[model samples]
Target: MMRASVLLISCVLAVAGCSREPAAPEAPAAVQADPAAVAAELDALLAEWHESELKANPIFATALGDLRYNDQLPDMFSASYRAEQEARERDFLARVQGLDRNALSGQHRLSYDIFIADRESSLAGNRFPAWMLPVNQFGNYGSFMAQLGSGQGLQPFKEVRHYDDFLARIARFPVLNDSAIANMREGIAAGVVQPVPVVEKAIPQFGAHAVDDVEQSVFWGPIRNMPADFPEAERERLTAAYREAIANTLVPAYAKMRDFLRDEYLPKARTGVGQMHLPDGKAWYAHNVRVNTTTDLTPEEIHQFGLEEVARILAEMNAVREQVGFKGDLPAFFEHLGTDDQFYFKTEEEALQAYRDVQQKINPRLEQLFDIFPKADYEVRPVEAFRAASEAGASYQSPSPDGSRPGVFYLNTHNLRAQPNFLVETLSIHEASPGHHFQISIQQEVESLPAFRRFGGYTAYSEGWALYAESLGKEMGLFTDPYQWYGRLSDEQLRAMRLVVDTGLHYYGWDRQQAIDYMLANSSMAESDVIAEVERYIVIPGQALAYKVGQRVIRELRNEAEAELGEKFDVRAFHRQVLVDGALPMGVLQTKIREWIAAEKAKAGA
Candidate 1:
C-alpha cells in the first residue's frame, strides 16, 4: 500500500491573485486578453499554491523534505479550518476561472485542467462530513503525529533544533485531539459516526499512546536517541522539556481521546460497516469511487468485472496447481496451499530475508524492462509493531525529495502466516523496486514538472502501474518458478476480490462476514489475513478497487500501443511515455498514449 497524500485527491492548486490582489475579481472569462501572460501568471499561482499547501500541511512538508514549518501542526478537524479551506478552494476556483486555460498549450493547459478538476472534486466532497468520521481503524491525524514524533518516521532528530521542532509540534497535539473529539461529538449528533468495528479496533491504538511509563512510550524515542553532538546544556534542557511534554501534553491528550472513543464514541458508532450506512452515503461512496478510480464506472459494473477477473485468475492458479502436480480442485487446492507449511515462512527474519533477496536479484534485472531509475534508493524493514496489526501485509513510504530519507518498504511481521513464502517476489515488485518507490521517487526527482505533479497522484494510474509491473516479472526473467507465477495470480486475485467485496459492502449491502467469506473462498489467504483485508476495505471504501481498475486500463493501453506499432513497438519507450508525466487520470493517460501512437505511426510512414 502507498502512503496516502494529505493534499486531497490531486493537489488543490490555486490562482493566487485572491491572496495578493487588492480585491476579489467579479467573475471569470472564457478567454483572457493574453495567452503568454496567462501562462506566466499560472506559474506564479502554482508556486504560491505549493508554498501555501506545504505551510498548511506541515507534516506533509516534512515528509517531502521541506522543514520550514517543522514546528507547526494544524487543527485539521476544526470547524474554522474547514471553513477556511472551503473559502480557499472557492477563491482558487474564482481566480482560475479568470484565466484562459484553452489559450495555453502543452503542459500549461494540462496543469490548468488538473488544477480545476482537483478544486472541483474537493468542493464536491465538502458535502460529506469526513471530519465527523475522522478516527478509524487506520489512525488519522493523531496517529500521524505519533509517527513523526517517534523519530523513526519522516521527522529527523539529528540536530537540537529537530528536537525543539518536535517539542513545539507535540505541544499542539491537545488542540488537535480536542478538535477531533469535538468533530466526533458533532458527527454523533448528525448521525455520521464510524462503524463499530472501526472504533473497536481504534480504541486500543489510542490507549497505546498513553502508556503509564513515559520513558517507555514511543514518543520518548527522539529523547532516547538524541545526538551525541548536542551541548550538555541543550541536551539536558531538551530532555526535561520532552519529559514534561510527553507526560503533560501527549499522554493526557491521548488518554482523553482513548476514554472518549471507549466511553462516548464506541456506544454511538453504527453496527453496519458500509459508508452507505450514513446520510447521503451512497453519493459519498460514488464520490470516493470517482476519486479513487478516477473513472465513472458504477458499482454494479465494477462488481461484475471483478467477478469475471476472479474466475479468469482462478483458472490461471489452477494451471499452476497442475504444473506442481497437486491432485485437487481449485477450492481444495486453496485450502491445501494455506495449510501446507512449505508455502509458509518459519520466522520473521526468514520472511524479511526473502524480500531482501528478491530486491538484490531484481535490481540488476530491471534494466531489461526500463531505462530510468530514481536517484534515491530504498530499504526493507519490518512494519512498526504498534500499527502493524491493522496495517497491510506490506507498504511503501516515499523517500524525501532531497535524498535525506531513503524509501522504506515495510513488510508486516505481525503475522508470519499472513506473509506467505511464495508472495515475496510479486509483493516486492508491487511495493518496492519498479513499484511505488520508483514511481514516486522519479516523479519527485523530475525538476521540470510542477510541484503538484511531482507530489500528487491519481490512485488508478499509480496503483495500476504497480500491478502492471508485477506482470512484467515474467519479461524480466523472474517468476521462473511455477509457484512464483502463482504468486502473481494470487496478488491479482486479491485485487479482483477487492472490486467485488468493496462494492458488495458499500453498494450491495453485504455484511462484514459475507465480505470476509468471499475472500477466503476465492483465495488462499489465511483467515487472519482475509479479515484484515475485509476490515481495510470497510474503513477505506473504494481504495482497494484502484488496483485492478488501474491495472486493466494500463494493460489495455500497452496492448493497444503494441498492436499499433507492431515490431517497432518498444516496451521501454511505452513505459517512459506512461511514467514520464507522473500520475494522470486514466482518461488523460489514454489520450496521451493514443497521441503518442499516432506520432509513432507518422514517423514510420515518413
Candidate 2:
C-alpha cells in the first residue's frame, strides 16, 4: 500500500497556488543574457527542487512511477520536516529572485514567474497549523491508503519484488498512524481540530479497514489478484507473507487508528464548523481563499459575486422551466426535477451505461471545437463502494504520463436516484472529454515543460477549465434538450452556491445546517448529496471557491479575446493558448491570453 506520508505530501503539493495587476505589455523580443544559459540554470534549479521533494516524500515519487524511493516513507507531519520544507522553499525563492527576470522571455519568463509564486505561496502558507489538523472526511490518509492497497490504485504488485516493496511500506503504517494521532492531539490542545461531524464520519472510514480476518482485509487485494504467471511455490510464499502482513501489521495499524479516533479524538473534535474558530483562523482562511482561487477577492466579495451569479443563473433556470412548461415556480421546478422518477435511472448499470453512451456521442464531435486533443484515453468507472457515499457526484483522475494507466472518470453510483439523465451530458463533458482528462492529460504529455509545470496544478485553473468546458455543450450541439440545458444551469448553480456557502461557512460563521439549508433552497441536489458537499466545504475551506472563480476569469478572458479580435478569433487557437502551457495561476493565465490576443492582432495586421 502507498503510505499516507506520501499521500499527505501529494495533497500538500496538490493543494499548493498569486497576484492582482493589469498584465504588462509583452516584453520586446530582446535578450539581456544568453537565453540558453538562463534556461539551463532554471532547469538545474527545478531538478534540484524535484530531487529534494522525492527524498522528502517518496510515496509521491511512486505515484509518478519513479520507483527509486518505493521502499521509503517519511514522517511528513514532523515539525522538523515542515521546518526543512519551509527553509528549502525560502532558499529556492532567494535563488529565483537572484535570476534576471528581464533577461528571460517567453516560456522561460513564464516559468520564472510561476516558480517564484509557487515558492512564495508555499512559505506564506506555513503560518497555519495545517499539519495539526491533518485528517478529514474528504481527504483522510486512511481511505487513500486503502485504495492503494486494494490492488486498484497506484501501487503495483506485478512481481515478487513489488510485493516485498509493499510489505516494507505496509510495516511503516503504524508509525504514520501514531504520528497522525500525535498531530491530532496537538491540534486538540491548540484548538485547531476538524469539525465534530466531519471527524465523526471519518471514524467509520477508519473502521472499514480494521477487519478481523486477513483474507477479508482490503489489504489482501494484491494476494487475491496475484499474477497467474508466478511459479506456484513463489506464489504460495508471497501469499503467506501478505497474509501475515495483513493479520499482524495492517490490521493492527488500522485498529489503532480506528480506536484512537473513536475513543480519544472524537471527544475533543470541535463542534464548530468554520475555520474562524481556530487561532488566526480568519487569516488562515483568507490565505486559503487567495491560494485556492489564485485571486485577491475577499470573502465578502466572493459572497456577493456568488449572490449575483445565483440570481442570474436562477433567471436562466426560470427560462428553462418556462420552456419545459413545468407550470410552477423556480423552487417547485427544482423539487420536481430532483424527485421526478423520469429524470432518474432505475439501476446502477443503467447509470453507468448512460455515461458510456455519452462518451460515444461526444468523441466524434470533439474535433469540431478542439484542434489539440489529448493522446491519453480515459475510462469511466463507478466510484468504489467504500468511499462512494462521501465522494462527489463525479471526478476525474489524470492519466499516467507514460500511458501505462488510462485516466479515470469516477462517477458516484452510490445513489442511483441522484444520477439524473440530464446530468449525463454536462457531467461527461466536465469530467471527461475537453474537461479534466483533456486538460490534464495534454499537460502531462507535453514533454518540453519542466516536471513541476507538467505535474503541478492550480486548483482554480484546473477546476475553472473543467467548469468552463461545460459551457461548450451548447456549441458542441449537445444539451439540445431543455432539461439538459437546465442540468448545465444546475451544475453552474452548484458552483455559484459554493461561492456563497464556502465563504459563508468559513468567513461569515455559517453553521453546517445553514449551508445545507441554503443549498436546499437554491438547487435541485438531493439532501444527502447537499449534506455531503456542505460537510466537504466545511472540512476543506476555500477549495469550493475555485470552480466559479476560475470559470468566471476564463469566460471573461474569452469574451475579451472575442471582442478584441472579432474576425480574428479562432476557438481552436484560443483553446490551444489556454491549455498548451499546462496549469497556471489565474492572473498568469490572463496575462498569457492577453499576450496571445495581441500577437494574433499583430499577425492579422501583418
Candidate 3:
C-alpha cells in the first residue's frame, strides 16, 4: 500500500483575554534543528506513514500479522481512491523532503533518504496507469484472495474471530472484483489493457473458483481445517454462514469476473506484449527501469550489460561442461541437462524433497560464511495448486514481525521438469537459506530500524542480493559437483536472460515468442519455465532487469572491497555490512561499502 501523510502537530496557548494576553516569551536564538530532534520528527513521519499504509491495504496488514485491519478491504482501484492516494503521496513527499536531513546521521539519515526516495518514486509512478490493468496471469486481488482464503496462507484460522474477519473480507471481494472490471473498462476506453495471452492465462484460475458447491470453493478451506475444540453448534453455525457467503457472494463474484474477461475484456485486450505499445510507453518503461534497478542505467545499457554477463557465464559453463567431459556444444549441453532423466525428479514428492535436502547441506556451511543469523526460522512448502500454474519457480515469504509465522520458501512443483535436480541447491540457496529467507528475516528482525525499512523493500537490493547469494555457493564449497555448478550457471543465466529479454520486450518491441525463443536459445531452462519467465517480464516490466543489475553492482562493490582491504577483507564482515542495513538502492549500497572499506583501512593504520 502507498503510505499516507501526516502533518506535524501544533499547540498554542489560547486561554488569555485579548487585552490581557501575557507578553510573548523571549524568542530563542536561531540555530539548526537538533540532530535528535530531526530524527524524532523523521521517525514520527515514518511510523505514522507505516500505520496508514497498513490501514490503506488491510490485507497487506493481515499478511504481516497485524490483525487490526483484517476485516477491511478498501476500494483500491476507484478513481477517487487513487486520487486520494496520490494526494497522500504528494503530502508525504512534502513533509519528508521538508525534514532537516543534514543534521541527522547514521540510521536516521538513511531512513530520511529511503522515505524521501519512496515517496518520490511512488509519486513519479502515478503517471503510469498500472491500476487500470491490475489483474493478470501472474496475480491481482482475485488470486491473492484465494491464497488467503485457503487455510495455508498467513491469515490465522485458530479462532472464531478469524473466520468472521475473513467472512467480512470475502463479502467485500465482489466490490473489489467489480472494481477490477470497471478499471478494465476504463482501460479499454483509454487504449490500455493487458496483453491477450496473459489475460487468457487468468481465465481458468478465476473459473476454478466459480463452482456451485460451497464446499468445493477455496474459501471453505478454513472451515474444513477448523479446530477440534470448537463446539458442534459453533461449527454448524459458522459452516452455514460460510456456505451462504461463498454460494451467494464469493462464487458469484468469481463467475462474474470469469465471464467478463472471456466475453468482454479478451476481445479488447492488446496484441502487443510489451508496454512500449502503450501511451508514453518509452518514458513509462524508463521510470520502471530507474525505480526497479535503483540506478540511472537505461534499458539499452541494461540490455547490453546482460549480453556481456550471459557471455561470461556461458564461458564458465563451457568450462564445467568440458570438465564433465560432455561431448557436446554449450547448447547441446543445455539440452542434455534439460532432457536427461537423471536431471529431473519422477514425482512431486521427490521434487519437493530435493529442495528440502538443500537446507541440511547448507546448515553447516553458513558458519563459514557469516556471523549473523535471523531469529525467525523458515520452511519449504509447495506453491498451492490453484495458482501454482502461473506462479514463479520459487519465492520466499517473510515471517510476521510478531514471530507467529516463519518465512516460507514456496517451490512451484507445477512442472517437475521445471524443478530439476541439479538446480535444487542453487535455487534453494537463492530462495531459501541465505537468499531471500535469510536476508528478509534479518531485515524484519532489526527492531532498531523504522518499520518501513524493516518491512519495505527495494527490489534491486533484495533480489540482487538473492542472485548474488547464488554465486556464494561456489565460495562456500557447496558447488562441488559439476552438475550443481552448471545449475548455478543456468540459474544465473535466467537472471542474465531476464535483463536482455525484459529490455527486448519493453524497449525493443520484441514479441512474446521472440523473448521466449531468446531465453530457450540462451539457457538450459525447460520450455515451460522459459514461457512463464517471459510472460512474467511482460506483465511486470523492468523487474527482471533488477536481478542482474543488482547482482552486478553488489559484486563490483565486493570485488573492490576485497581488493582494497586485502588481508583485512573478511567475507563475513563484508556480508555483515551488506545485510546489517536492510535492502538499499544500488547507489546507496556502493557508497556504504566504500565507506566501510575506508573505515576498515583506517583500522589497519591505527
Candidate 2, residue 232: Cα displacement in angstroms equals: 1.4
Q: If scored against the real structure, what TM-score would every candidate get?
A: 0.95, 0.94, 0.94
lDDT of 3: 0.84
Q: Clashing residue pairs in candidate 1, if any?
A: none
lDDT tens digits by residue: candidate 3, 1-606:
011111110011011111123335546875657888888898899899889889887877987898999888888988888988888888888998787756677878767766766776777788899888978988767888988989898788899888888889888888889899999999999998999999899888899899878888888999999999988988999999999999999899999999999999999999999999999999989888887877778888989988998899889999998999999898998889899999899988888877777888887899898899888887889899889888898887888877789888898999988988988889989887788888888988888989888887878888888989998998788889888888889899888888899999999999999999988888888899888888888998887887887888889999999999998889999999999998777767777888899999999989
Per-residue CA lDDT of model 2 for 192-302, tens digit only, reads 888889888888888887788888888888999999999999899989988888888888887888888889888988877999988998999988888888877899999
RMSD after Cα superposition, model 2:
4.4
Residue pairs clashing in model 2 are: none
lDDT of 1: 0.86
The predicted structure with the larger TM-score, 1 or 2, is 1
Ranking by TM-score: 1, 3, 2
Question: By lDDT, is 2 or 3 better?
Answer: 3
RMSD (Cα, Å) of candidate 3? 7.0
